[model samples]
Target: MTDRLKDFIENNADGFNDLEPSQDSWNKIAARIGHSEKVRNKKLRYISIVSAACIAGIAAFIIFFGKPQNQTDNFAEIPEVLEAEAYYTSQINMKKEQVYQMAGNFPELKNEMEVDLAELDTIMVELKKDLNDNVSNSEVVEAMIQNYRMKLMILEEIKSFLETKTDDQKNTTSYEL
Candidate 1:
């Protein structure tokens, strides 16, 4: 059987060679394969582009609109700043309380003090944001301390003014008596 098959192939080899496919047929097959490949490549390119755009959009969203990290964690690392902030905060609260008590008869003065303190509070908030954005900005921390000092100074001055006014009233009453 093997000898017969070999003999048949030898006899028909020339005929098989003579019946080769046309060049046009080869070109058509090549063109079809090439076109399919091009379509596949285009689909792949579009998928990759869309995927990249989605990744970039997600990254931007997380950067711009994500929940803010706790700022106290950053401040915790700076013990001196924390101590100063606590100290100044306590002092400021005490002084503000004293000023409020003394300025009961002076609503205008209280309002003025609130306006000034509010401005300082706004500045302090901006400084805190700056500090959060840049974890350890010494200048911003110093500015925050200075802002506290200014608030304390304003309260002290108002308290002194009220004290003098009270003393003057007392002296006038004594002289009248």
Candidate 2:
């Protein structure tokens, strides 16, 4: 067993021979590693700089151009009001025309009804202006009530006319029979 161990040691002794690296080779290897590290650092620095510039540019855009001005924001917010105004204006205009046509059909009350409708128009304009100005004028409310009353009066007159015509038809039919 001792003889086998001695032989193994002798055989492996050559593997542990002093094989010192040459100075030139060592320097070359070190220089290559250092150059590669520098290149890698430079690339990382370039990427960081580019990323920083992009972030700065995005921030600048947000500060200067991306955000809307107050007036623009307000304008954007007014579509609801505009839509409501359009709807109200159309409704009022139609009502006005309907009232006028109904009044024209009644020859006896046409002039008086026209005068009332004119008053209603003036009142509506004032009411609209007051509403726009954020002033809750009681006069405007009263004017709206008056307009509603006038419309009711017109409808009453139409009903009376229809009733009279029906009565006249019944009378003529009774006479014929």
Q: Please, what is the whole-model Cα lDDT of each candidate in the order they appear?
A: 0.67, 0.49
Q: Which stretches of candidate 1 lie over 4 Å from their true place?
A: 1-76
- As for model 1, its CA RMSD to the true structure in angstroms is 35.7
At residue 126, give the lDDT of candidate 2. Answer: 51
Model 2, C-alpha of 16: deviation from truth (Å): 99
Candidate 2: regions farther than 4 A off: 1-106, 137-146
Cα deviation of 64, candidate 2, in Å: 47
RMSD of each: 35.7, 39.0
User: Candidate 1 on 102-177: residue-level lDDT in tens?
Assistant: 8888786677678677766766666676667753365556567667777776677677767877787779967995
Clashing pairs in 1: none
lDDT (C-alpha) at residue 19 in model 2: 94
